[model samples]
Target: MLRCHEVTIQVPGRVVCDHLSVVFEAGQVWAVLGRNGAGKSTLIHTLAGLARPAAGSVELQSTDESARGARARARIVGVLLQIEDGTYWGTVAEYVLLGRFPHSHPLMGYSRDDIEHAEAALDALALTTYAGQRFATLSGGERQRVRIAQIIAQRPRLFLLDEPLQHLDLAHQARVLDLIATRAREHGAAAVMVLHEPLWITRSCTHVLVLAGDGTAHCGPADEVLTRERLEHAYGCRLREVDYGAGRSFVPDV
Candidate 1:
């Protein structure tokens, strides 16, 4: 479990959220929803102990008060940011293998188990063909897939993804999201992703976290929190829900 205790987060010009407390459980997929610049990424960074909160604290499942919390958290938490700098000058395999650093022995080369995990992750993401290719040469979507493969190879207990499908086609989007969900359930891990699409939330997530862009946030089960009104309030737009076969879909009333 990841617990935030009365956390307050703010940006240089805007307050993101104030005194917000929430808990994320294992084996559950949660979607973080908000408009642009609502601090969705900031909140995720804070959860990963990459950013400092204004007043409160984030407690990871591993409560090893002896060692540095951030180091301990990394052993259990996996983070995928929205973008990556193109400065890395290495092959795809080398980049993906970096994820296994937390598990491998220091100063020693990657073990056979680590190599197998990296290979399996590449195979899962269909990136085996690009293993020897330079990371800078891959297209944006391809790079995204490789990063996803890296995190999968890491196999952390919790996954924090920000706009993970930014550069993917429809098929890859579904495939990646499904893969995350399947891996989460199979490993009893947790996923908290920042996404713009409500369709993915409905299909892949069990919980919802909506930042209203007004220094406030709401969270609950997906079914209870993803109503048209809640979405409209979070997005500040008119929306309508329509029955899509047996399920439903939300569209803007414009």
Candidate 2:
């Protein structure tokens, strides 16, 4: 549902990716893999229309992303940034309800359907018990789950998640990954996530994007792009591949 055309992303002294052309389609879960400072987060922001690329353009559903109004865009594209402001002083339920802002009427506020969506999202994330808690009082992992729940409530056609597994425990991580994968597989939503773990990609992602942090990138089906050589080069380290019943797993040689 999102396409990047010859996109060039740059940081202060480094070019993240150059002439990067890729398409993220419905029913696919994509993983963006890279070392720290490799511009994974930058690329996500650019794709979400929160940042501008040095060259080329990004399109959502065949139209220029930047051309759409904020609410209109939010209705189709949901984003979870790596970092979030901690200034929100609302209750957890209130905070989650904010996800419906795009769908809410300016004068009428959130509808019953919006509340149902938000409640279901919270339940999916296992945050039903914490609905009355203050958002700032929750633990890091809990907060992360809440953020993800907010996005789920939005029910966007495309999900752009930057480090979605951050601060999450193994169980929560699996839950989140499965949730994303299920959304793509069953609901036809597209997801592009910045993930540090290769095993998780093998478990759930259909496509892969590997960035070498030098303006070079590899993108294709996960099985084809996640070869030992490319992963080693992109990660700048040695990895041992292990055969598993479901798929392959890459572990650090060290």
Q: Quantify all predictions' global Cα lDDT against the true fold.
A: 0.89, 0.93
Q: Pick the candidate with the highest TM-score.
A: 2
Total backbone clashes of candidate 1, pairs 3 or more residues apart or in separate chains: 0
How close is every model to the real structure, measured as TM-score?
0.95, 0.97
- lDDT, model 1: 0.89
In the range 1-254, model 1's lDDT, one tens digit per residue, is 78999999999998898999999998899999999999999999999888999989888865446435554556688999986664899999999998888778777978999999999999999999999999999998999999999999988889999988889989999999999999778878899999998888888999999999999999989999899988899888999898767566688999
Give the Å shift of residue 8 in candidate 2: 0.8
Instruction: Give the least accurate 10-residue stretch of model 1, judged by summed lDDT.
Output: 62-71
Q: Runs in model 1 with CA error above 4 Å?
A: 63-71
